[model samples]
Target: MDSTRILIGASSAPRDGWLHLDHGATSEVDRRPSTDPSTESVPTGRTQRVEAKGELDRADAASVRVALAEWRRWMAPGGELRFDLPDAGAALAALLDPASSPSACDGAETALRARADGALWTAARIERELESAGFDGSRVRVDGGRLVARAFVATSTSPSNSGMATDPTSSAPDGAARDESNTAPSAASHTAPTVDAPTRVLVWCGGGERERLRDLLATYGRVLTNRSDLELLCVFDGRATTAAAFTEAAGAAFAATLGTAHGLRLGCVALPEDAAGLEALRAAAAIRIAIHDEPLQLACLDLAGHVDPARLARAIGGGITEPANGALDDELVRAASDLHPWFYPVELAGHRVVPGLGSPCTPQYLESRTAHRRQMLVDAVLERVDMRGRRLLDLACNCAYWTSAWARAGASELFGLEGRPEHVAQARLHWSSNDFLPEGAWRFEQGDIANAADWKTIRDHGPFDVTLCAGILYHVRNYEEILRWAVQQTREVLVVDTRVQDGDEVLIDEPGDLRFNAIESTRRKVVPNRARLIAVLEELGLSCEVLDVPFGTALGVDHDDDYAAGRRITIVARKVRSALPSARLGTSSTDLR
Candidate 1:
């Protein structure tokens, strides 16, 4: 493929798909062409990294291992080798400093750094440069494009249990009554998802100011501390004496000071004329950073082999849901119990425990009740998503669980309009933190789940692409009226997950104070009739496909989940096509009715 430009922060790194790379592997190497200051030099010691893209072929693995081993010897103390080998080329040579000429593509015998840590420093220095230019650090590699080699630095955060990480930031507490056997499980580290590429960040900051940067790093660190593969490194540039130098020294100081304090290897590039000057100090720093902890990147890749990507994607989604709010009331009691606040792993940690869901769950009687509710959520989700790209509206989106999945599936927009103050607040917190999307694009409004008095205010701000109505169908007294109201608000697709049941079941919330009177009859319990939902859609002159999804205690079933023989039924319906397909993603919302 034509070389792709990888964006790393503000910088860029050029990349070519070489024969040796696989997903998730990482490497560090010295790319400087010659150690001879008399010959040529442009920058500091450079390194070439040949990390596996994911898993690699046995041949490529052997070749990389052989090359790195040989490189280690050449880079060792008092070990001096010349750039004469024709096969490996000047890729290694160029990493030391910019090379005299691009090494012949056939591979040339280039001088090698004997120390793996030295290679790490060289790789990290190169990463800083690449990032400063705006390249995705993950894309840095060797044998990219016409070049002999490029270098990179990398790490992973796998929990070590057979690659299953033990989280330091444990799961959100269910508020199970605390007993001797249970203490809040330690939180899990913010590990790269099993199926996803490992995350790497180079914090460039000042040396003494590390205390200032600690909080920023801590936020990410707390989440991933339990991960086995994550490596945090600071890269520092030189410092300035006067505050005025901040304008010039800010970037450098940020790199140098913080990097130095955090024990990050320092890097400064010196010109050949000053080969042994401050420039070498800079180069040496960069080289040291590149080679430090080089093996971890490789370890992460090996661990990557154990995870199934598709499974991880789903699991990560589960990780972001927030805990449900307050004490369970009548209406909520009717809902399943297993309703964990979405994004529980991140949100309800350290403080703010969920009642009855954690270590000391109470009135175990209610636990079984909520267990059914949890199934309702999962079943409802499976149904709503069947219609990808169909616009959706999640009314009363508590933590926007469906909205997220819909968004991922390419739903135009699952406008999560919330009326409940508690749900709205919970949703906002998750969104702002990137625990969910930054703005919760799927979320646009919050107010009475049963009312729309402020809808005009919402429009003044903006409109949604699709609408999702979750956690609201049972609360409203005027179900049909609200259904029409919600449809009128949607532009194209609309998916609503609500309470329903077979004829006259009169499903009462387990707490049994509130009521879902005259419930619409569907195929089964706590679900409204498909025809009733379609009636509203047809009256509005739209076609809808009603698909049933698993729910209730089905969520409680672990592993095969075979125990959830049957319980709740979730129906997903959406507009088939718009009379106007040409409408922009924004302008279409008003057409929902």
Candidate 2:
């Protein structure tokens, strides 16, 4: 990180709110009364020194020290009294002119003694900034009066899902200082944010211009907000900025779309973009998905009409107010869905096929045949599977990521079967390119429910113990015949995973009361079909465990990385009697419902 310093010397009494910045994010100022102790204090003795704390590099801190000292001496009725805060750069140019605000008073001894004790407020600010930068001063000696810090900045060159510096200190007022070295005279009281050179800069811009503003805001707020990662909504303008910002956008969109769009305002911050925004966003870093290249694009949209409950729901639940610029078509948009909700709390090392959950058990989808449904399907399968485990299968696999993982895991066997030969080819290309296919473990074959007879690729493997069949259920036109056929092929476990919707809310308490609503033909879009899927493996005498859970799919809402509001389930059935009439499993398409 480069550092530079700028010093400003002022020789006048500090102006009231003089430190409040007016640089236009073109937004209103944060006039909301601060809850800080300084805000409540009554000014008493004229303080000698001044201090600013936030995530800033070395040059920035030095620059501030020089500026503050010069300002203090210039304002000095007898000595410099006012101080200037530095920007993110020039923190290292701390050489304040000694003549200005020189510690020459007899009272210097007392001030020095008092400073040695450290004021709570100022120390807290410095401490917070240091911690956020991944530096804990607990190990550093405080008497030396230096706040040490460490931090990491993100670097990604992806086209859609791009990122910038993550370190907070690079933009803070100064490098961490024990702060007492520059604390105001102990007897003096402070006021609201010092009305001098602004200690914090809030950069705001609308639409695409948000990217630049975001970096500026990120630099300052990281420490000012006492967070390593600031959740964008922290407003330097307080409420007026966001309120007026959203109000304008809302009125504009509503007036333009009127009632035709059904829902004009799309999405709300759910949480305010205040200090609270910083808190809420910090936890979701793992899955903190950015929909647009610019994080600010969602800023207004998130805070829009959030106060209005009915409006809020309509915006989020309705269709995409504006189609995502398919730029994210590849990145962020995993598999294909906007928000993949595949991660769930299922034991992977030893997961059981729960009864009545629908089709396949614990095994999950790795990649999508289509980028559109990729995230949603990956999210669903991940929800069903545990986080651990190096070995996996991509049965009926489209992308073959499961086989790739097993090969990567150096598994004994990683089998991938796709109904389409082209898909198998694509899967092979991917696994091979990634160097994930092991010498003997990974295998890909072209096999479909209509015709596995000629699908010789899988024949060499023989009757395998475990297999994954996902998305094939609803696509299987011959639902019954396919079920029996799939059963005969499996020796130990047949994972019959598929989509099932509760067509009626009249819950059937008895498992035997289950009935197939309808069967999907060979050529049909299964996503929107208003029918429930039922596994017909019972005739094969397999002990069928039906899981009625519906994971999010192409037909459903974007799945959160955490499984929520999905309708996909997995079924693990054991083949008890392969003796079920083999003639019954022939090519003749049979409808189960």
**Top candidate when judged by TM-score against the true structure:** 2
lDDT of 2 by residue, 36-103 (tens): 11322112223222222331222333343343333333221221121111212111111111221333
Residue 258 error, candidate 1, Å? 40
Q: How badly does each model clash, as a count of residue pairs? A: 147, 68
Give me the runs in candidate 1 sitting further than 4 Å from their true place: 1-392, 410-415, 435-444, 452-454, 457-463, 504-531, 548-567, 577-593
- What TM-score against the true fold does each predicted structure earn? 0.32, 0.33
The C-alpha RMSD of each candidate to the native structure, in angstroms, is: 24.1, 25.2
Model 2: lowest-lDDT 10 consecutive positions: 354-363
The candidate that wins on lDDT is 1
Tens-digit lDDT string for candidate 1 (1-593): 21111111111132343112212122322221222112121112222322222121222323444533433222222222111111111222222222224453112212222122122112122223333432212111222211112322222111211011111112212321211211111112112234333333223334324322332232222222223333333333234222333222322332221221122211122112233442332332222112112111111123233223222211211221122332223222212222332222223321221222211111122223234444444445454445455555566566664455455555554455655444465555544434333343445566553444545544543344566665456444445556655555666555555544335424332211111111122111133444555555565546665443343222122211222332223344455644332222223333322
TM-score of 1: 0.32
| Model 2 Cα RMSD, 1 decimal | 25.2
**Model 2 segments beyond 4 Å from truth?**
1-204, 207-394, 401-411, 419-426, 429-437, 446-449, 452-454, 501-522, 525-535, 548-567, 582-593
* lDDT, candidates in the order shown: 0.32, 0.31
